[model samples]
Target chain A: MFGIRSDLPLRRDTASRFVVWLVMVLVFMASLAVTVNSYIGVLIDDWNRSVTGTLTVQIPIAAAGDKASAILVNKVLDVLARHPAVAKSEAVPRAKITALLGPWLGNSEAISDLPLPALIDVEMATEGTEAVTAVTASIKAAAPEAVIDDHRVWLNRVMSLAQGFGVVALTIMLLVTGALALTIVFATRASLAEFAQVIDILHVVGAKDGYIAAQFARRALVQGIIGGAAGLALYAPALALVAWLASRVDSEVLPDTALPAAHWLTLAALPLAAGLLAMLTAHITVRRALSAKV
Target chain B: MALGRKKAEEISGDAVGLEAVGLHYDDGPDVLKDVSLSIPQRSFHFLTGPSGAGKTSLLSLMYLAKRPTRGNLKLFGENVTQAKRGRLAAIRRHLGVVFQDFRLLDHMSAFENAALPLRIAGVGEAVVQRNVNELLNWVGLEDCKGAYPAQLSGGQKQRVAIARAVVNRPKLILADEPTGNVDDTIAMRLMQLFVELHKLGASVIIATHNESLVARFPFPRLHLDRGSVSILPPLASSAEFDHDDPRG
Candidate 1:
């Protein structure tokens, strides 16, 4: 598969440079998307394992009157603290809640006067969704009007983003694969046209159509490998910079952004995969082109 | 080799048999009309024709490069008029053709060019190198073995093409003006090589415009004019091809 010698002068063609560059750019984007998609996989697993079952207990100011809302929060916190699954429980101070709303409404003093729900933050220790159902009854017994959020609001949004990005990355790789195949076909035909006379001579010398096609296949394979390696070289640094930026973000919703070391080996194999793709595509292209002759 | 799934010697009457063959390009007048020919195995013939006399076209047919537009064509006694492409390539393996343009691959060295046929036949590298070196030396191209076509002279390129054609020792040898670019001395030497192959078991057909060169070989001639053929008889007294003579 790695044979280099060929009867066609494909190396002399200027289109090789164009093909190599196109493949390089395409492979770089594909590697980046694929690696990011890989990292997102870890993030999705983390979200499912640790974050999906966490809950928030809220006492709306409307359901329980403003003064009663404060009392209802105390009952819920006591109920959560007594539960076996609850790892920690705390009531969010009214001043802190008002401060969080300062960005959209006004200053803390202006927003503090308004009615707002009493919020209790609970961290559940267990990893199963059953933990949410087990504690729901206890919290409701303490305060019947208590609203329990399994944190599904932001959890579903982030989960959707991760899965959506994975799908988008997959689509990008598909487009890259299609474009790479087309590039090989066009380049093979151009190389074939450039060496048409040489091929005719090979035919006269009793060389089979497979022999001639193999020469072009080798050329395309070489181009694919070189271009793939170069593209991966560019992608490594780009991905590192992205990981660094992602890790630096302070949002609580973001998952661990560090990529594992073993994935580099998988990414390293992309060059050979690209080479095989180029070889197969080129072989089919040349055989079809030559079949039309005489 | 026969065009069908048959061995070379299994089905045999003539090496080549063409019955009322007609050919033409798309929507064009017939380049060859009602062309009928019968050449026995191991026989040598010269194809003589004017510029547009379809010598190369006829050679193309004999080597199975193209099928006749109409009528029956046979190689090694197998009818190939309706044969498959793979069958045509199988038969082509036994036929060697030296094109008029000296279509040597510009990328390959002269030695590689000559070794191409043997390599395609799945011969080992050692045998390819030995036989190619021997043949290149015979064509007086021993020194230029490592040279590419672009680096070699016109006559040198023609010699490389000839070496490539004959290196396989095929059953039939066809050349279109194989000696067009070389001097009379080298030309005669090259023709002597062809005659040697003919002496062994290969049928040979050479197309040429040089009458003096034709006068030296005692082979029968197939003369073509206006898309038709006429047979020319050989000389009454056969003359030997002198190996040492500069002018034979």
Candidate 2:
């Protein structure tokens, strides 16, 4: 609309519309990849915080009537409480510990007859492995039978998996951007060829290369916006369905998939970015084609 | 016959000046050669020749559509043979060309096709509307303003092309066989439109082989034959060559 309103026809054929739809699908894929990556990052952070600087002390059942095991557990708790690096220490009640193992060991009479260790949960005042190591040593000196489990091995494995997912998501985003740019270039060349006579008329009428390029750029930008919005519309409902499904599942098994407000805002910017990419690609292509003419 | 009356009174600067200009296609034979002439400002001339006489090629040079292979050409007093491509558009804006094909865009209506020049020049919308409407009406196509080029007859499309050429009141108009597709009556009407534009201080050049039309008008002639040009005298009166004209 900003250009000279001539009878010069714009692309309205099926081929052109297919180009727009292709761009929409590419943008949708890119947005979905980024959103998934963000969610993975949140999950990793949650897992890390849940495990960092925390230790579980387990004392095996004593040869006597459970009195010796209770005394060893009290000795481990006393050592953790007095340690400068310890924040809070609590003895896990037998019922709660039994409930934690209910899914694996079952709640039948056989589970009650089995010899179970007394467990003490310890929260450390300082983070990192060094503090946890020092606290473990102090606990071990008091109760030799106590074993300290800091959860570092499992945390490392989860982080490694999250990083691998991040790499894949990044690769997907790059591929989508590349594909969108190529589609725009192809569409511009096709449009230029289709309207060759119209371009000649415009040139004869004294329209400059910049002016012609602006016409194409404006048209491509509008198409980009429409396609981008359509892609986002599709992504939104899919994201909602995924969130609903995630909510129905147990959070301990699967981290919460619902994206935060900041991540949604980030995804909202995808359409605008797509529009800008389309405009720039169209402008460059048109100018390059016109430069070859008289 | 009055030969070069305007050329004799050449006190004013020429609208177009060519000195030994030549043109040829890529690795092809020369299409135009050694053409030297000056068209004084506001004068009307007819370029007459047979087909394949490089009439369109010569006009293409005048409109900056092609650069001459050799020699100097001045348009509106500026040396444009070597002008940069970026600067050529400004000079081209002062020229209006009517192609033999009647190049009206098929997508635009008659009014929009005619309004192209003014719009390209960034004229105000109100002025473009008024000028385009008045010109369409003057060309006798006011009723067809909303019609596309495909919907119009040959004569109507030619008229639309002419209207587009003069819409911005260009300083020079080069029409290549503007009436080639129309009847005698429509051709004469189109010539009259050019005459009116010439009277308004625009130099006009019409390329045609129709001797009858040339004899009907006493304008000077730049006759081209075998890639060469010669300036011929204007007929003393329309009656002198009216009987000898073959196209009559």
Q: What does candidate 1's lDDT look like per residue over A174-292, in tens digits?
A: 99999999999998888888778878777776667888888888888888999999999898888889778887886455666456675677688888888899999999999999989
RMSD of 2: 5.4
The CAPRI class of candidate 2 is medium
Q: Which candidate is the best by DockQ?
A: 1
* Span of 10 residues, lowest total lDDT, candidate 2 chain A: A6-15
**lDDT score at residue B240, model 1, on the 0-100 scale:** 51
TM-score of 1: 0.87
> What TM-score does chain B alone reach in each candidate, compared with the true chain B?
0.93, 0.89
> What are the models' TM-scores?
0.87, 0.88
lDDT of each residue in B1-248, candidate 2, tens digit only:
11124344333658899999989989899998889989988999999888999889999999988988999988876778988766677777778999999999888899999998788878999999999998899878979999999899988999999999889888899999888888887787788888878989999999998877887787899999899999998853657545533345
lDDT string for model 1 (B116-174, tens) is 88988778999998999999999999899999999998899999999999999988899
